[model samples]
Target: MRRLLVTGGAGFIGSNFVYFWKKKCPADLVVVLDALTYAGNIANLDAMKNVPGFEFVHGDILDTKLVERIFTDQGIDTLVHFAAESHVDRSIHGPDAFVRTNVTGTLSLLNAAKAAWLDRGSGIPHRFHHVSTDEVYGTLGPDDPPFSEETPYAPNSPYAASKAGSDHLVRAFHKTYGLVTTTSNCSNNYGPFQFPEKLIPLCIANILDGKSLPVYGDGRQIRDWLYVDDHNRGIELILEKGQAGETYNIGGSNECMNIEIVRLICDLTDLRFRERASLSEKFPKALPAAGRASRELISHVRDRAGHDQRYAIDARKIKTALGYHPKESFEAGIQKTVDWYLDHENWWRALMDTLCFSKT
Candidate 1:
């Protein structure tokens, strides 16, 4: 069996990818190493707790010794690194953690991978796949096309800057040391297990609780939304077929403004809840009063500092080269995501009460 070490496997995207990977390739031995930080909840991977060919390590990527030990002891021949400080607002509040986890931690992993693979020589089939975000490309104007692998680094927020630094490290390691590296810069991903701090989940959770749905600034900032499952499939494709020393851009080709996304979620929530009440004779809460649609719950707040106005990805390369196309459209994906949050309120509510997220 091929041994794979996945860092940050408890985070949203990482956890989804881990679950999908284990099911898709049952022969592969998967070991997840996560720090279990505030955002990295172990509950995300509870379903896989007893699966065969899988193991979990509660650890941080910043610890070089632990990383090296995993690589050496696990006979890890492949790496799918997803660990990073990814929240833009949190990064702004405290950039020190971002630098430590994203920049320094990435370097440590590269060094460990290089040491582990170098001794095996070039004939060995070893690879290091780095998961990244398109925020590293900074913002685009209304007329500007989507970002491609060729786009220059123009990160804006502290989170993006940290990720950009890590991307550079991956490139340098591939060029200077032949570490057999591949990187995929993806757009925003939404699905089950996403921490409630993000926009989609935050809105879903708050709307369910009858609280205000905060919208940053005018809520016109646009982002490409790729379903978490689609994003995971792209990453798996790249790992198996993408060339070494190459970067691929992954996206769903579904771009929508923040306000538009919020409205869609509101409409979906109303439909789901209204139907549920009809069948179960629950609270039977009346619809919004006149001029008070669910949209009324939207409360414009201060925009984040250095918030990117728009982010879109040019995924033509991945499409043509790898024959990859997203299976779920934005409408279908959002509905599924909304339903997941609605059905699993306890999963997210536990997180909210534990984290004590502030609406301010």
Candidate 2:
């Protein structure tokens, strides 16, 4: 069994990955390292506390000493690097944090891994898997083909640029130090335990609260939306059978417009309210609870600064090479996501009181 250290394990995709990994490999030791940032919630992993071989460490990835200590002390054989400052609007307002955490923090992890696994000559087989984003390819023309692994880096936002930097660092470590690394640049992800600040969760939360569903520009931006669990499955395959020093692109094969997604969430939430009488009592303020449409809250706002037009992923390499493919269709995945938020009000409500979340 692999002794794994997962960074950012309290956040959206990371937490989901942690759960997925544990369910598949019950005997493997899974240690989570998170700083408990605005997005990271320790409660995400609360269900696993009673399980054996599970450990949680509250810390920053930038702290090389602490990271190396965890590596050496825990005998960590695999490092799944997911810790990152990943909000687009936040990056636009405050880019320093993104650069510090994404670029410098990645370097720190690389150094710690190199020291613990290579420098000591322990001869332990190891791997460093870096999770990246498809935004590094920038926007796409309406008729242009989807982004492939060979797409040139042309990041438009500070968040994307910072992630691109980290991706380069991972490649450098593999080439220069032979760190046995693999990277996956995945498309947009949505599922349970996601921060309410993101599109799907944000819309679901706002719709329940009878708040405006803010749409940027014309709201026609296209994106390939990957379910969070499917993204994790791709990573699992890569870790099991992937070649070192290569990068994989993971996608959901769902290309949808922003406004279409907002409308879908609104329609789905309304359906849930209509189907359950208890929901109206729980969330009386919801428009659907009053026999009105949730889509009435739709409000068009100013577009984001430097918003990318579209992003679609060409995931053939992973599918052809390692038999990796997404299992969830958008219709089924979105309904499950909406139902999760409806059932877990306390989870997202606690996160809603934050100063940053209020502004968003």
Question: Candidate 1 on 187-255: residue-level lDDT in tens?
Answer: 999999999988899887776656788788999999999999999999889988899999999999999
Question: Estimated TM-score per prediction?
Answer: 0.95, 0.99
Candidate 2 to truth, TM:
0.99
Best by lDDT: 2
**lDDT of the structure predicted as candidate 2:** 0.94
> Which 10-residue span in candidate 2 carries the lowest summed lDDT?
351-360
Per-residue lDDT of candidate 2, residues 200-310 (tens digit): 999998888989988998899999999999999999999999999999999999999999999999999999998998999999889999999998998888889999999
lDDT (0-100) at residue 55 of candidate 1? 96
Please give the CA lDDT of all the candidate structures.
Answer: 0.87, 0.94
Q: Kindly report which residue stretches of model 2 are placed more than 4 angstroms away from their true locations once superposed.
A: 355-360
